[model samples]
Structure formats: C-alpha cells, structure tokens
Target: MTVIDAVRGDLAEVRAEVDATLDRFLAGKAGTAPDPCLPPLVEVLRGFVAGGKRLRPLFCHCGFLAAGGSPDDRAVVWTGAALEMFHTFALVHDDIMDRSAMRRGRPTVHRLLAEHFAGSREDDGVAAERFGMNLAILVGDMCFAWTDELLDRVEVDPPRWREVRALLHTMRTELIAGQYLDLGGDPRSTADPVRSAWRMTRLKTARYTVDLPLRIGAALAGGDAALMRACGAYGRPVGEAFQLRDDLLGVFGDPGVTGKPDLDDLRAGKPTVLMALARQQATPEQREVISALHGDPDLDEERAERLRDVVVATGAAERVERLITIRAERALSALRSSSMAPAAKASLSDLVAHATRRAR
Candidate 1:
C-alpha cells in the first residue's frame, strides 16, 4: 500500500494539512513574483516541492505529539511547512552536485533549466549545462530564503522560537559539514574509510533526514531534556537505517519503481558503508571489477550488472541489509522504553517502515 493508505487517520490529516500549506504558500508565491521572469521560476519550485513524501513534516508532527503538544496546534504545522521548504533547497543543490539527471521520475531542475535556457542563450554561447547550473543554484537560494520566511510566519513565543532556531542552526551546519565529508570536502574526515562513511551517514543523512526534525518538533512543544534525549535515542538509529536502505536502493532498486536511476550513486562512487564493506570483502578479481567499473563516468548497464554481482558476491549487500535490520530494531526498542504518549509511540512505530523500507 502507499504511505497514505497505510498510515492511520491523524497522521494522514497532517500530511494533507502540510500539502495544503505548501500548495497555498507556493501558489501565492507564483502570483507575487516581482519580475515577469520570476513567476515561472516560482512555478518550477512549486512543482519540485509538490513531489516529496513530506517525511520531514510527518516526523516533526510526530515529535510534537510525543512531547505532549496538541494535535490542533497550527504552529507545529507551519513549522513542518518550513522544514519541507528547506528540504527542497537541499535536494536541488544535491542534484547539481551529483549531476543527477532525474528526480521524482522526471528531469531534474538543473536539466530542465538547462533546456529552458538553451534556446534563449543559443547565440550568446553560454553553455546550457553551466547556465542551468547557475540558475538552479539561484532557485536553491530562493528556497533557502523561503524556509526562513515560513518559519517567521509561525506564531510561537520568542523563547520557543529561539530554541527552534538554535536547533535549525545546528542542523544546517551539520548538513553542510556532512556534505563536505561526502565530497571529501572536510579535512577532519577520518582516514579509515568505513568509519568516514559512517560519519557521513550520521552527519548528513541520519541527522538531517530524521533526528533533528524529531527534536525540532519536540522542542517546539516544550519538551524537556529527557524527552529530547528520547527523541535522539529513537531517531538516530532509525535515521541511519533509513539511509542505509537508501544506499541499497540506489544500487539495486528498479528505476521504474524507484523513480530514480539506480546508476547514479554507483557512478559517483558515493563513499557509502555498503561500498566500503564490499571493497574490504572483495577478492582480488572482484576488487579489479570494482576498480574498473565503479566511478567510471561511462559506466553502462552491462558494467553495472557486473559491479552489482561483485557486491553480492562479497557478501556486502547481505551485511548492509543486516545492519539496517539491527538499527531498526534499536529504534523500536528505544520507542518501547520511551515515555511518549501511546498515540505518538504508535504513530512513530508505523513510520519506521516508511523510513527504512519504502520502495522509492
């Protein structure tokens, strides 16, 4: 079943509310563009924002409820909206860096922009790829600005807002730090490659995707230190499992089902723990296969098939799967021991599957 079908009533309510908030916000943005050229840009941003699973917002609401906040509170709802907008900014820039061709089963924003600008700049000799990259960067910046504006609209008291902003500042900082690690852009990255990959997963994927969002919601609800600590206990492992599963999917998932190419991460030689494990376990022959095909810009379906075989042959894929299961269990164990409301606990339990096992 789809996530909407699988989740119970109240969770579905927030999903609908968050979607409405985004639609209304972006629609108004489209109409209010100061320049004629800007409206279409706004529309593109709107379309991009419309495609995600709203995982961040859902997690945020779960945290709020867990912290004893009322379900009727619109402040948490708007905060969820802000989270989704920030996610948009992250995604656009990520695609550019990964040189991804598609997202949500469609051409990525940069590629679309490249095509859009190609004709206009045909005679000026500006390369389409460069122009597209430049414009998409601006679009990402716009989302960054919009995220702050959305947060500004939430009617929370100054103290609560201050706490939330501090959490956001930390989240944003770690997000950039994690990205640099992934890009080998950090000087402090460990020399041990597997440990480095794990660090990147912790900083970039796990914390960004799940941990801080949960805490942000909890903080908004005035959750105390113990409650926020509980949020971390459940969130950190679940988030790690979530990203580990994504690593598997990126290499093995069906593009038709995933709505994303399986080849990109493999092509980028993303320094995932999965790859680290595979390399360590590989025989010399298998090692040669990896060195030959992985990270090759021209890697094709036939070669990717060989690399997939090597990963499975080395037992790396199986090992990663085991890690995901272990991490998920850790999360569930943490949940069972928490003092969260039963409704909050149950909703979070339901979401673990979404976090770790969704096809897309």
Candidate 2:
C-alpha cells in the first residue's frame, strides 16, 4: 500500500478512539441528567467530527512513526486522536467567527442551530435566528471542552506532554493572532503580498496544520531536538503548500469534491495569496470589479465567477501556483535531509506530494 493509504489507516484508528471517548463522556453526562440541549450538542459534535478528513491526526501518526514509534503502540494513536480533537475545537470556533453557513457540505453548527430554532418559533424568524446562534455558540464551546478533556486523558510521559503543550500553545496563539489580523482589515493595511501571505499562512495555517502535530508526535516518541527541528522544517513548507492548494480550491475547485462553493473565498475577501497578488497587479477596471464584489455576501455565483476570471487574467493564480511549487519542493528537500528512517522518509515524502497535488 502507498504511504497515504497507511496514513489513512492510522487516521481511521485514531478517529475511532476519539469517537468512543466522546461517546463515553456524553453518556456519563446523560446519566447525570444533562441539559436538554446536551444531546443535540453531542449530535452536532458528531457531525463536525464526521465532516473532516482527520488530516491533523494523520500528520501526528506519521511524525510518530518517523521518530521510530511502533504502529502497535496505542499511545501513538491516542496522541494522534488528541490532535484531531484540538483541530475540531479550532474549526468549530472558526466557523462561528466566520459566520459561515456550511462546513464539509453540511450546515455549520451555528447555522444548523439557527435553523432548528427558526422551525420551532411562531413569531418572526429574527428572534429564532438569534436564539439558535446562541445555542450554537454554546455547543461549539462544548466541543472545545471535549478537546481539552481528550488531551488530559492521554497517557504520554510528562516530558512528552510538556513538548506537546509547548507546540499546542504556540499553535493556538498564532492561529488566533492570524485570525485577528485577518479580521482587522485595513485599506491602509500593509500591502506586501509576500509578507502578508507569509504571516497569514504561517500562523493561520502552516504551524497549526502541520508543524505542531509533527512536533507533538515526534516529541512523544522521544525524538531528539535535531529530529524534531527537522520535522518542523519539513512541515512548515508542506503546510504552506497544503494551504495554497486549499486557497486554489476555495476559488476554483469542484463543489462536489471540495464540499464548499467555488469562489467562496473571493466572496469572503479572505485575503488569500491569490487575492493579495490580484490586488497588487490588477488594472483600475479590474480593481473596481474586485472592490465592488469582494466579501459581498450577496454576490451570486455568476458575479463570483467574474471575479475569479479577473484573478486568473491578472495572473494571480499563476503566481500562487509558483509559490506552491516552491514550497512543495522545499518540503521534499527537508525530508531528504532529515535523519528519519528510509520508510518514514518515503511516507512523509508521499504525504507532502499528495497534499500539494490534491484537487481539493
């Protein structure tokens, strides 16, 4: 089997463990006469978990294996599961903050809750919408709580925990900082595409998505500082490439495969590398079109496609694709230089290639 297949196998195992732990936790609460909304909240959690590919857990497992860990050791799986739980926590909050309506093709937690409230109300829909959002906020909090609980239950050594803690803290803090930067937009914002994109990509995507998980897994396996550093070096570039691919998908991907509308990022004015580049190079007419339509929630698919055409015609797509290629190469080079076993090196290389080249 290929490395991706192996990674998927490991991710499935970790996901199952997380599922059982969450079920048991919910059951305990149920037995104690939990809130009426708690059952629905758990149902939302299940939906959220089901929607993901568990990429974080897969990275964690791969890092553990690269650090000389055995597949049979259950701690590796538990550690991987902890990363997935943390990722779920982040996504739940992100969707709320983004005011997103969908995730992985299903209604977002807040949106779903709002819909439920709307159906039950006799009066106008506004009050119901507000109530549903409130409940979703609470349910998302519960998911975050469960993430912490999962981490607390892991049986890794104290030193390993410390290492994982450091990475987790960095990942969480950096992502929030990136989110703040993203939300706090400026007409006068620093307009350097490379600088802005790097800042956003590193904190918002790279460190959290790839580096931290790899470090956590490797550290848990008692990998040396050199090896851990190598993982970070390797992961950063791969993560950036992965996000670049995601940015492309956000604009140009197939809705059926991506589980999100194409060009949704353009409508959201996500400040992605593509957008930054487009802004840098667009003609006055092109800029006008972008400014008029970007982040406009009312923008229909036809208008969104027009904006996408502008981005492509302006060569932003080409620029971003070049960067993706560069990052992918760097990731491969990092793996080659690392001291990991040959099989592990092959696995990581395959992962980097797959992530960078995927259509969605």
Candidate 3:
C-alpha cells in the first residue's frame, strides 16, 4: 500500500465523525449567535474548517485508542473537535502572518475578508486590506474561544481533563515561541542556524503537532506515565520528520498538488533545517545566489527555481531526505516496541508515512 494509504481508510472514519461533530457544533453556534452579523462569520469558519486533513484529530483519536479508550467514546471525538477548532485558530493567524493569499485552493481568510470589505465599502485598497487583517484576527480569537466551548461539552474525568489542559497549554506556548523565532529571520551568516532551525521545528511542529495531540488523547483516557512516554517516542521523531519533509515540499513540491504556492517559503527565506543545511553546504557562488534571492519578498517562480537548484547542488535536499528516513525509522521503532496495542501501533506506523511524506 502507498504510505499515505495506510492511514486513509481508518482516518476517514475518524474524519467523518469529527467533521459531523464540528458541523453540528458550528451550526448550533450560528443559530444561537448574539448578533445577526456573527452568523456569517461562523459560516465562513465552517468553510475554512471543512477542508483540513484533520490529522491532529486523527492522531488524537489514535492516542485515545492507543491508551485503550473505547472507540465508541464520544468524549474523545468531541475533544478532537475542540482540537480542530484550536487548529483553525492557528492556521488563520498563521496565514495572516505569512501574508498567504491562498489556502486549501481558495483565497485565504484574511484576503477574502479584505475583498469582501472592498466590495461593500467605498474604501481605498489599503483600508480594505487593513480591515481584512483586523477582522481575520477577531475571527481567529473567536475560534480560540470556541475551543473552550467544545472542550466544556466533553465529559472526561476531572483529573484527566486537567492533564489534557496542561498538554494543550504547553503546545500553544511552544507554538507561539517557535513562531516568533520563525519570524526573526536567520541570516545566511548566522553562527548556528541548523541548530536554531531544528529547535524551531521541534517546538512549532513536533511537540505541538504530534507529541501533545497524542498525549492529550492518552490523557483523556487516563493513560499512565508509561503510555505517555511511549507516545512521545513515536511522536517526536515523526513530527520532526514531518516538518523536515514539509520544508522540502515547500521548496520543491508542485503547487498544483500541494495546493500551496511554492514561492512563499523561499520568498520568506524560512530558516528551515533544509535551508540551513543548504547554507552550510553551499559553495561561495551558490551561497551568493541564496543570499541575494532567497528572502526577496518579490521572488518570482524563476528565481525560486534557481534557489531550488542551489539546494540540490549543495546536496541539502538529499541530506534532508536522509534526515526524514532516519526519523521515520526511529518513530516506527518506538511504535513497534511500545506497550500500545498492536492495532494502535499499526495505525501510528502508518502515520509515520503520512506525516513524513504527504504531498500537501
């Protein structure tokens, strides 16, 4: 089976249920809104939420199952919905910060908002864009607020709920700190960019995206410390591999398949491990190309292609491919050796492939 195919059917089941739960919750939210104007925003949110791969929630469910929680438990599903809401908050805000114009093959939330404002009001272009940014921020804040609402509805044990909350809090803090470091560019001449980039990857994606989500699910099931430790074993390497592959994809993936503009990561000069590796291995001429064009805000497709060549020439892409392989192997080894049930271990093993190799 294809690597992603392993997770496809099983994950689809979790996805459908979680999607239904979110739909019902958001519909209820819209129906009970304090103001007429609020319903429209919720509709927009539903649209935005619909297109996600739901990887976090799937991992959450997997953790629940891994901890011997019953698949029939509504709490796990509801809590997964809550995590999805939180993810929406992150993505919306992330797009704003990235100045991304497209998401999930559609106009980004903030950009859509800007166009809406521009169409409705006789405002200058800058005013409409500013309005869009402000409104999108509010929308992200609302998603954060709704996460509490979703979690409130889930009836887990008090002690377990506390643990889950702690995990979520840590995830958010790490994500924000990582994002701040991300926004602070790593100049080509930085003393130790590879180390910085790896730290950022672990904080922003590894712990936040995988480790905590798995632990959160396990927590809801009252999993013991041993189970939590096992989840970390499978989670950390897989999450880092996931981000490292994503870094490669960002620079080298087809925009048509990935549904993201290829230029953004390069244009932003994201100090990803992939980039740091390239900077380290580059010849002086190749280093010159990266320095002059890597972070240019107005970088075009052709220049982006040239940078891709530099990465390949420096062997950074091949080295990153090796990194992904090692991490995936470590994650799977952890899964195989963990005390988690065989069925759960199998599913997580599948995830190693999906997280590390997905096109989008």
Residues 124-146, candidate 1, lDDT per residue (tens digit)?
A: 53478888888899999999999
> Which ranges of candidate 3 are over 4 A from the true structure?
1-8, 185-189
- Which residue pairs show backbone clashes in model 3? none
Q: Could you give candidate 2's per-residue lDDT for residues 108-144 as a string of tens digits?
A: 8777777766777785777776676777777766666
- How close is each model in CA RMSD to the real structure? 1.6, 2.8, 1.9
> Which has the better lDDT: candidate 2, or candidate 3?
3
6: Cα error in model 1, Å:
1.8
Residue 125: error of model 3 in Å? 1.9
TM-score of 1: 0.96
TM-scores of the candidates are 0.96, 0.90, 0.96
* Model 3 TM: 0.96
lDDT of each: 0.88, 0.75, 0.88
Report the lDDT of model 3 for residue 213: 93
